[model samples]
Target: MSDGTAERTNEARGRRWRGRVGLSIQSKLLIMLLAVSLASSVIVGTIGFLNGRQSLHDSAIDQLITIRSMRAAEITTALDAVKRDASLHSRNLSAQALSTSINEGFAELQQEEPEPEDRAALETYYSDVFIPELEGRTGDSYGDEAFIPDSVAGQHLQAHFTTQNQDFDADYDTLLDDNDPGDGSSYAAASEQYGDYFSRLVREAGYEDALLMNLDGDIVFSAYKGVELGSNLMSGPYRETALASAYAEAIATNSVSTVVLTDFERWIPSLNVPTMWVISPVGNDSRITGAMAFQVSIDTINALTTGDEGWKEQGLGDTGEVYLVGRDDLMRSSSRILIEDPEVYEKRAVNGGIAPSIVKRAVEVDGTVLLQPVDTQAVEDAQAGESGTTTGRDYLGGDSVTAYAPLEVEGLDWVIIARIDSAEAFAPVSEFTRTVLLSLLGILLGVSLLSLLLAQVFTRPVHRLVGAVHRVAAGDLDVQVPQGSRDEFGDLGHAFNDMASSLRIKQELIDEQQVENEKLLHTLMPESVAAKYKKGDEAISEAHENVSVVFAELIGFDDYARGLSPEQEISHLNTLMRGFDEAAEKAGVEKVRTLRGGYLASSGLVVPRVDNVRRSVDFARNLLGVVERFNAQNGTSIGLRAGVDSGTVTSGLVARTTLAYDLWGDAVNLAYRVRSVTGDPGVYVSQTVYDRTREIFTYSEAGTVEAHGGTETVWKVA
Candidate 1:
């Protein structure tokens, strides 16, 4: 085979293949509809499912936070209550001892006489012996100072010292006189009497531990076992400047002061370890003599977070566990199921110690004692002070939910953390979501199958109408669609058949009419131009340059129309414009605009095919030819005017719906003004228009006239 024959054979083969692979219109439409429906269903279902899951998760976390917060508050309240009871008991014990000492000193002073020297001597003895003895009996010490006995000891003691104006002087005299040999024997006797009173108060008040400390921060008395008298704490490592300052602050304000666990050594090795100290001042003769301190254990605090007594029966599942975590991010206590290690069961004295690794993970992971998975984002939020629940994987690789809350204890700043397995936390929600999705999927499948069956039943008759349309498009208008029922599809089938039958009968008539219309349009414009315009292309105007634009108007058309009937005026104007249309057609004008009495038309050398000044002049001259012809044909008194100018004018269809193409810029505007300024009924042309078209038309200078807004020279076409 030759090269040309081989190419033709290949082209034919390609065309056959394309035809075989192309989809039918109905098949394409069906596929598109199904795709849209499936995508919409999936998008909506997925969104709904995700929203439901998130809502459920948020609700669970909110409940967990509330429980943790309440637990922390309860723990703080209990600790405060213990401290208050201990404080009241210590204060009452010290008050009784002080009262007894004052009474004895007053009695001794009343038994002595008044004398200056004897009073001085008595005051010295009181300061050296009586006061020191009283303070020592209370487990407090007075500093050493020598005494000198004076003459008439008892007489001067009462007479001068008793009557002294100074309060300290009088107190000295009272101390010397009131040191009855019986009272100075031992404070044990006074303590025994007051001990019973304080014991009853402590029992009623429910104090766990209380201690009275002297001015030097020594323990004068203690209700707790093993803490002895004269246990100096002033120079202890735990009793630093900060502690002393805090103690002094309590005394100065006369209010309770608290100290949190500072170091591990200070903690007692016991199952229930105290973590806080509450201190208050003990007074004697309106002076701060010592301080009363109380130790409050935080074991109940840990229990509140991790206790499972009520929770286990609540059916939170076997995977769930609650535990307490301290500020060091260690577990302080654990729920029974989680407390497998000996360290956890032993209740190691962790009062002032760092939390262990397990507890630390619980606190750091979710800030809750209960171990559970948490949302990663929520965990990060809690780290920034939000104090909320989070879900994530646990050390055992199980899903877990965890919650954390800041415990603002009166003395201890710590965090409480709780966590439970996520599978357990969300078991109920998971079960619900699974059940709903399964049921929905089943219903969707059943409904889809039912819908497919119904669609096949209803589309049977419409299929015949669809066949007829396909046959018509394939050049078989004689085809008829079958009608089986009175439903919409059946009615559509009948309508299609009737339409095909009518088209068959009118086919010849339509062909003849279309041919005649095509010929008429070609007579009015070039066949190519008319065809392009009919197809809605403004290519001629769009590609044009240097076009001569023309404007025409009937000077009194509005008044003329007002004087005549609407029908008569329209008829007369149409008859008058017939010549202008013919003239423009002859001149190859691409477009025209008829606005009531005003007419706008443009053409030129400027259009796609022509680009010469002479062609523009020829086009304008033809317009003048049509105006003269119309005047001759009418022979009536009606006058006509036209104005023409040549310049760059951009022309194109301004809107898609309207097939009208318009000319713009100074040339079009100047042309309009030329027609406007014409004194009488005659064609006028601007200097630019005249210069371009003078050789083609007879014209004379119209002279310079101020055209509406400015002056410009124009010429008349006569």
Candidate 2:
């Protein structure tokens, strides 16, 4: 062709290519329709999801608030009734006469010391029964002298009531009528006179115990006649108890109308179970002789706070509950979890940051009052006299919606809290979100299919050209367009064919080099990370707050491989490594790297998981199983040892030219140190890992090892 003719032809081809570059009218309409449709679906779905979530949250908060208010009112009413009963009994003529007579009787008994046998029996009872039971319940060690009564009268009463009777544990009232050991003594005479009346009053009024203490702080009279009877609250072993505090307050007030209330505490006389007291002056205002106290019933308090164990009936859902917390940050009521599922309660309480000793005490007492700690935000806010609702972590370390308020009981620093798990509260919103997503997805699929069909029908001649362009855009440079018509469409198709043919040759060469680079990159880093490097991300690094690291090594592989050839050694090592990789994948662990004789793996590195520690431990155990299988099949005597640690770790590409991805942190270093410790070949874990998984797996103390310039405790899984 002539130069002019060739130039004209090239210019025509360029014009055609430019014209095709702009989207067709049908394609433009389709794109606009899809964009609008998707935008509408997303906007509507988001609005609905947000509104539903807010509505559910408000409902949950309202329910919790209602429960909190109701329980607080009930507790206030119950406490007021208890105060009224104490006041009524204190003002009674018979009670005042009994108090005066009991004080005189106890003073008379103090003149004669108890027999040596009686003293020995009292000491034995306290050491073998009372102190041991108290120590077991409180997880505290105590000597016999810690609880032995110093006063002669107190010793005689305790020995006669508790040592002579073995059924007191079942019923303290049983000792009320048994006064044989002290037939002619003044203490026995005083008890014989008013013991039946007080016991009857306790049974009828639903009181745990009734007490009469003189202004001198001497507990001269007890309805049930336990160790507290005849004991001095002023200078005796029970001087520091809530009962003592109530007695002191009543004596200080020295008024007939005053009713002193003290919060619950572990009472040694009651075998360390939770006990409270309400005290009143026991004589006329002119000359008060003593104080009368009623030991408050824990069952009544628990019934009010726990809704009489009818939590679900009171609109509290499956995991919802109302509880009380004292100023000491310990519970004043029973824990619902401890009532429904003791094992789960123990696990949740320990894992939720409560001390194991506290949980053990709660279990031993068969109650949570004055034992289970509830030092949560709700408790703190309520103790500060704030009444409101909040969404945060509950005492069990689970997300929950809570309502808190201060309880209005006289002389008691207590608060009420109502809470329910967030999962149960927001379940409806979660369901609605899923429904909206599925609906939007269906709409998107339907709209895309319909728009594509309409576009194909309207632009039938451009269909083959459009398909070829889509294929080329999708990395298929070998695509070619057919030219069956002699028009602009045919000319465009022919031009497109030539361009694709030329691009295909260059793309093939580029792909060959790209594949080799990707292979080398992927071998060094994780696939997801290599993709970032391929996209030109030079500084690749991440800080994981809760990743679990595992260090696994072959125990006898070096000795076994000494007699083998290099080829066989490499093959065997490759087999072992491949097996480890498979086990790690199955256990949700990521292989970080392999050293001369060890393999390092991590969980919660690439993907965060709440149970990463558990997965790492599982992976370590599986590595040992892999080796055992290999030994069984190949007749090899090699063993596997593994150590795990869970904590913060930083992972990144280490080198510029020779990209090496590596992990470094306390967790990694500790894991290596634990694995290298001198011990038998087994799976061992750091203290953190052991704490997180101790309930799930059986373990024994593997002792401590030096790591990171400190001693780290370790445990071995059995």
What are the per-residue Cα lDDT tens digits for candidate 2 across 1-718? 9966975896686566557555655467767887978787878777886777688667777777888888888889889998998898898888887887778877887888567976788778777777776676556788886666678877777777766545446756567556444648876777787777788778888888888887788777777777787678989888877778778877887798899888887777776767888889988867788988888878988889888899999988899998889898988998888999988898888879888887876776678997788768988999999999888998778788889988988798998889888888777777877888887887778787878786566566877787788888898887766666554566667778778977887778889988888787765666777777767788887677999999998988999899899999998898899999999889988888887678999998877799999999999999999999989766698988898999999888877577678898889988987875665799999989988999999998878988667787888999
Each candidate: RMSD to true structure?
31.2, 14.5
TM-score of model number 2: 0.66
TM-scores of all candidate predictions against the true structure = 0.38, 0.66
lDDT of 1 by residue, 593-702 (tens): 77666667776632444433444445555655655565565443455566777777665545546544556777777877777574576677888767766777788877
Worst 10 residues of 2 by lDDT: 174-183
Candidate 2, residue 181: lDDT = 47
lDDT of 1: 0.53
lDDT of 1 at 51: 69
Q: State each model's CA lDDT, in order.
A: 0.53, 0.82
lDDT over C-alpha atoms for residue 378 of model 2 = 87
